[model samples]
Target: MRAVIATEPGGPEVLTVAELPDPEAGPGEVVLDVAAAGLNRADLLQRMGFYPPPPGASDVMGMECSGTVAAVGPDVEGWSVGDRACALLAGGGYATKVAVPAGQLMPIPDGVDLVTAAALPEVACTVWSNVFMVAGLQPGEAFLVHGGAGGIGTMAIQLASELGAKVFTTGGTAEKLAACAALGADVTINYRDEDFVEVIREVTDGRGVDVILDNMGAKYLGRNVDTLATEGRLVIIGMQGGTRAELDINALLRKRGAIIATTLRSRPTAEKSAICASVVEHVWPLVAEGLVQPIVHGTMPLAEARAAHALMESGDHMGKILLTT
Candidate 1:
């Protein structure tokens, strides 16, 4: 099988196509004939040597994939060869074939194409688990998402809106913010030109938002606490901004706030499977009903994984970037 490998940690230049042995399904796992794969910010981080795959994970890049089941291992049931499915993985997506736990597999929702299905698992699991499962964003409550035009942000906005939350988001430019608004964001703030904390406070009548989905770690820590309601929750999924910043403990205490940070990729297989199972049961119907759809910015060949990485870094894309095998 041909897959992209990071020869060394650096730029996109480090990515190259290499022929590797095809992975076989282990107990409770399935082997997929890869059709399409999704590119994520974490993919770039892993390529730059800052993020390594968890124990027993593939060295190849790719977090989620949509493909057909080529084979299934022992103890797996309810699926068979040739099932059209998408799956979340720890790694090895940029290839013609990869193996994943059967529990992590999700049947492709009716009416969604294989390529688009590739774009769903990562963002869906990330947003659903963080915003709803962890933060517990409630209907009629204010929800703020940073990087509004991103795959994670776009999904978050739609999911929160579908659940009847008042959604707000921050982007770097007017166009990005507009895109966010079109995706059901009630308030869109240009973080470059406006103070999001102040804007969020003003929009919430000075009470602050009920929940904030953040990727900017240390940089937004203080401001996030400042823009929280009396019992608000801040969920951190990434650290795009610098990871070191001073914290105001008093602010958190005064607001009776909570801060939670996690990465889905590094989780144990059992945990990831549990999350995927929940998504399959609950969120899959939303896609099937056409209430939410995968927002794909572009697709490239698997061999051009480097170019995919370059496009993601440019920050010009509005949604998910995909790589097809």
Candidate 2:
């Protein structure tokens, strides 16, 4: 099997395709002949030595993939060889073969092809868990998501809008904002030119948003707090804007808002499995019905993962960049 391995902690140039041993399924797991892998900011961070895989996990730099089952291990049920599925992986997705826990596998949605399904698991689980399960975004409530044209943001906007939430998103350019609007975002703010907090206030008659899916951590912390409606929930999943910041305890207390920081990679397998199940149950139907769709910017060969990383780093893509076998 050929896998993308980082030679050292540095730039994307350090990533190289090399032959590696094929993975075998362990108990309650399945071995997938990977068709494609999704590129994410976390992968770039890992390549740069900022993020490491959890203990006892693969060192490869991918978090999600779609493929056919090549083999199944003992105790696994309802899946077999040749089943078309996508999985939320802890690591090892940038390879021809990967062993995945059965619980982390989802049958490809009815209308999605195998290659495109690679882009779904990560964004689906991330948005469904944070926005719906954790933040408890309700129909008719206002929702805000930063980085509205990226993978998670695109999915979040569609899912929230389809479920009846008034969706607002921030992007850096007109093209990106336009893409977000076409995906069902009701309000699009150019973060570089506008104050999103003020926009949210004006759009909602100063009520603020009930739920926010934030990727910028410290930099947006204060503003996110200011933009939240009373009893609002803000879930932070990434730290593109740095990690440390001062929080206004008084403002939070006055609004009765909650700030939660979470990461999907370090979670226990059981929790990941539960999230995958929930996504399949609640989100897959929307996808199957064409109410939501995978937003892939482009696909590259697995050996060209370095270029894919470069593209992500350049911020030139509207959605996911996929690496195909």
In terms of TM-score, the best-performing candidate is 2
Model 2 over residues 28-61: C-alpha lDDT tens digits?
9999999999998999999999899999889998
TM-scores for every predicted model: 0.99, 0.99
Report the C-alpha lDDT of model 1 over 104-180, residue by residue, as the tens digit.
89999999998789999999999999998889888999999999899999999998999899998999988888888
Residue 192 alpha-carbon offset, candidate 2, angstroms: 1.0
Which portions of model 2 miss their true places by more than 4 Å?
none
For each candidate, the alpha-carbon lDDT, in order, equals 0.92, 0.95
Flag clash pairs in model 1: none
Candidate 2: which pairs clash?
none
